[model samples]
Target: MDEQLHILTGSYALNALEGDERASFEQHALASEQTREEVRGLSAAAAMLAYGVEPVRPPQRVKDNVMAAIRNTRQVPAEAVVTDGAAGAAQRGHDGGVRPGAGADLRLGTGEGSGPEHGSAAGAGAGTDELGARRGRRSAGSGGSGRARPGGSRPGAVRALAAAAGVLLLAGAGLTGWALGQSTENNRLEQELAQAEQTQGAMLGILTSEDAKVATARMADGAVVSVAYAPSLNQGAVTAHGLPELPAGKTYELWLQHDDVMVPAGLMSGASAGSPMMALLEGQLSGATAVGITVEPAGGSPAPTTEPIMVQEL
Candidate 1:
């Protein structure tokens, strides 16, 4: 068996597969009872995980202040199917399972409604028809090149799985086998969250430290972005001002460059070209000598597209 296939079972169980992969894996799973059972167990654990988090109200002025802040900014329009970060439900389409977008690419850790992704975002819609068509073909399907339609089996399956997971969780459902792996996956998610919290804490420390270094990247149009980093912790943040908002289908992607290779750092949320927003750095930054930002398509690119509009040496 392909090790990668085995690894994806957990993400699939969580309904985390990006568009193309999710359809392919479901087809493969239909033939393997082991895979099917694993999905069920993991789905149940996911339900329990959802119940574990405690919801807290945002600060009293948060909404008003945020809304006021964004009132001056223009909205960036997009056509991709975006998912709810936690619920994993597909954003419903106009038609019912009728037309799926070109392809459902999986973009994890993107902000929804707002962080290119925050926890996660999956392409949904046309999911029902896409899965159905792929199932009809009986082989790995091709890349989708159109838009999303009304229905998708995968999104429906996600809803069903969440429902089942909730039932299993509340009912103390026990399986003699496969339960441990499910719990382990839940633990893995918890660990990841804990690590993210730690990173945030580290970033806070770096930003506050007097030893931190700062650099500013100036755009041709008089936009100024200030970046601050701590070499000791390998973390940083960007603050943008006076920049022009991009048109539809374009985004600003940050990169950490070293050894002539560019590692993705972070994505800036949509804001008024002249409005101010700060985004923390993502990805590893060791040995990085400079940071840059570029324009790319909606979801982002595997690599930088051209000369960066903003570049500042560390």
Candidate 2:
């Protein structure tokens, strides 16, 4: 039930946690309903945020090149197998005193040299058979080792190429995600900047108006609420300092009062107990004679549900 774990809900919802940190948080979340609910809320928010961004598609050329390489690459052949019969034949040829190169002539002389009184035909036939067997075995064994076959190591090369292609694909995907995230962040910052500019403009109008009137009320705790109202522009800006923090599920809500009727204004930014904050009051201020502050539900109520903590006549 460590309170510090609550801060990780954002990162967890974003799937940014890794290894033991991820496991530990998940375990803690299962045991704590508050943490679990927070994680769910944050996750839903993250999902909505993702849906807000436009989708990005990778270029077709990257896919085309990877597929083309896979299709064009050749498969490596299995190594040849040598049999016991071929070994025996080679042994016999060596024992018969037949020179390796001279065994070639035995095939050509077999038919002419055959005769009933001579055994030359039998001798020539045996020599030719043994020589051919030896040649076949030699070719089989050297198919994987000798210079005549240059593709012996192609299997390793093909595997390496495929691995490289996989790495390239992953890198490209990562870069795409990074670019998309950055774009979303930039858009958010731009919107925030535009809003801040608008707020500044409104505040300046109220403070610089020729008919502007400023009012203030001080609380028992020494906190102060101030409002600047401009009759010419029908707008007012509320500023507060040293406002005490309320209990959970409660917030400070502002109101514009016209006679006995109160209109809902904006809520405070929930700053710390003794912090300063300023916000332009919502709605027109022409008929409103005063501004009031009250403690209400977390989100402000449509009508004031509590007594005014402070009221300043404008």
Candidate 3:
């Protein structure tokens, strides 16, 4: 019992525990500030989880199902009064009489009458009255329909409908989250593709210009890297071949020598022994005197952290 009461903390925080369990947990929480604080923290976390996701509108099918449940379920009106038609008819005929002739017919308050108009045999006078009385007793407050009691409904069906509605809400939220995630990822990829296209266009302009100048450098490991510059356009492209692979968390970074300071250009792409990697220099090239390469950490650095592996004078 003690263990169960302790377990109610989470349910209490989410407002799921009710009746006796909720009352018990509230009493237990007042005995210890630590438990009270824990409940507060859990409650805040649950609220954050609910607010973190975007809300989605429920689908049409869910609305239809709920409406169908409401329409099928019978509700008792607060001041409704049911009238027993058979009992009313029997009372009206308290002075019993013989079954009337074929031409004689009578009805009171929409209740059946003992006559040939109702296909009653000549000998069914007392038998019909007894049957009517039995039906009236069986369905005293059922408006003489002789069916289930008025205002009764299938509680199990109502509960099942509620459970199904909860499931649909969860499913709708999951699908909405997935759709939002997909949209975000697609936007990122499209931006990257557009930037790549712009960079490729700039690099081609520099390399194909008539005023383009070329410079080459050789690394200690016999790798050849070159830069093509168009001074008129202030743009350039660096191409490297036969560069050896470095360990994880290391990269080749480029720098531009401007007067007395080394300005960071960008990180270089990896190259295999036979395949060449080309990259566009990030910034303007007209003021720089030379281009240099250095080995830096994975995401390059602002300042040169090591000596240049190769330097080519512009």
Which residue pairs clash in candidate 2?
none
Clashes of 2: 0
**Per-residue accuracy of model 2 over 147-180 as CA lDDT, tens digit each:** 2222223221222112111111111111111122
- TM-score of each model, paired residue for residue: 0.36, 0.39, 0.39
* Per-residue lDDT of 74 in model 1: 24
| Residue-level lDDT tens digits of model 1 in 21-119 | 543343344234355445444644554565568999999798987665444332211222222111323324533443432122211111245322122
lDDT for each of the candidates?
0.45, 0.47, 0.46
In terms of lDDT, which candidate is strongest? Answer: 2
The per-candidate count of clashes, in order, stands at 33, 0, 0
Our model 2 lands, by Cα RMSD against the true structure, at 38.1
> In candidate 2, what residue range of length 10 has the lowest lDDT sum?
120-129
TM-score of candidate 1 versus the correct structure, residues matched by position: 0.36
User: Residue 135 of candidate 2: its Cα lDDT?
Assistant: 13
